[model samples]
Target: MPVRLPGPAVTEELDRVLGDRAAPGYADLRRLPYLEMVLKESLRLYPPGPYGARETAEPLAVGEYRIPAGTVVFYPFRAIQLNPDHWPEPERFRPERFTPEQVAGRARLAWVPFGLGPRSCEGAGPAMVECRLLLAVLLKRFRFRPVPGHRVDATERFVRWAADDIRMVVTPRKAGPPPRS
Candidate 1:
């Protein structure tokens, strides 16, 4: 995230919301809507898993075709999030796209990094909360900058990952007490 303009803003937001506290409670996290946006945008760019499948309970119809019931449908999480029709600039990482107003204007299924429907991940809710908290705490305590000349390629497997591996430089922040474990 340090590679982009919004990345610094994200750290700024976390710092503002956290103030001088090394550890924030749930109440403090509640004020971090932009943090959530960053997470959402990150997920949109690289979801946990590459793809998910669901069996149709009833027949479904596409624009000009009908899918019979019981047919398993496969959907790529990244593809859905990157669709030009739904996302303005499919390749860019703009957390502003995840603003409440912008989200309300998109389709219900536009953002589903955790998968969707009844078969979706059960830990999705808790995972999101945990991620936000962890990110807030860590980013508040450190400045993460990408390693120079490191090229990251997305591996299209069960879970999304950098084929060359993600490398970064982490510098500890000198403000306030160390972040709570």
Candidate 2:
């Protein structure tokens, strides 16, 4: 999605933080705030794990009706994340919506790319770090352009999958000396 919706601001920020370096260190990754926002916004639009289920431990009241104990409750994360109520321009890819102030203004549970609560995925933190590091490295190393006539759609299974093959052309970046501090 980042490739499809390239933001000049994000690119400029990446270049500023990365300088002429081909790879980003931990500190460098931290400095790319816009890139982080882009990644999070991407996740918000298309979370890898789109749905989760939990069995009710006890009788629960939901609005007017009561759900009996042991009822399997499904959490449709994708739908929740895309709800227009929580996010303005829900379908549009806008990373600026994730600025610290904007995030703090929204409901605490509005963004749950990795699920929520104590039962949330244990690897969430590490997975985010890994994704940021790998994406930063790739963005630094190449420019991605979508291939003409390729179709990309979202499909749900155990995890969200692209419905069709996503074809992109990756052009290796020219090597240059790191920018002077």
Candidate 3:
């Protein structure tokens, strides 16, 4: 986050929400909406599972196309998330796209980083909470910047990840507001 426009703003939010707390706790996670937005935007760009497949239970119609029942349908999550129709400036890192008002305005399946429906990932809930909490604690304690000339690319595979891994420099942050009495 330190390399993106929202980085400093996120740090500010963390400082404000976790005031004198040293680190964030479970209850405090709900109070940090901006961090959640950032995580959503990140997931939209780099979904770990790039695609999903499901069998249609019933014949379906989309637009002028028709699909017979039992046909296997593939949902390309990365492509869908990057589609300009659902997400404006799809390649940009704009967390505002996930704001309550914005999310409510978009299609339900427009952002499915963890897949969806009955067979969707069972760990999605815990995963998101884990990410949010980890981000909060880390952002509060350190600043991260990509190492110079290190390009992180997500390869298409069973699960997507940077081939060489994303390299970054993490610097410890100075103490924030002193513990409140």
Clash totals, every prediction: 0, 0, 0
In model 2, which runs have C-alpha deviations exceeding 4 angstroms?
Answer: 1-3, 174-181
Kindly list the per-residue Cα lDDT of model 1 for residues 36-96, writing each as its tens digit.
8988888888799999999888999988989999999999998899999999988898899
Q: Per-residue CA lDDT of candidate 3, range 1-181, in tens?
A: 2234356778877888888666899998888899999999989988988799999999999899999999999989989999999999988899989999999999999999989898899999999999988888888888888898877766788888777888888899864663344
| Per-residue accuracy of model 2 over 58-117 as CA lDDT, tens digit each | 999999989999999888987888989889989888888889999998999889888888
TM per prediction: 0.88, 0.89, 0.89
Tell me how candidate 2 scores on lDDT: 0.80
lDDT, residue 105, model 1: 95
Predictions in order: lDDT: 0.82, 0.80, 0.85
Residue 71 in model 2: shift from native, Å? Answer: 1.4
* Candidate 1: worst-modelled 10 consecutive residues by lDDT: 1-10
TM-score of 1: 0.88
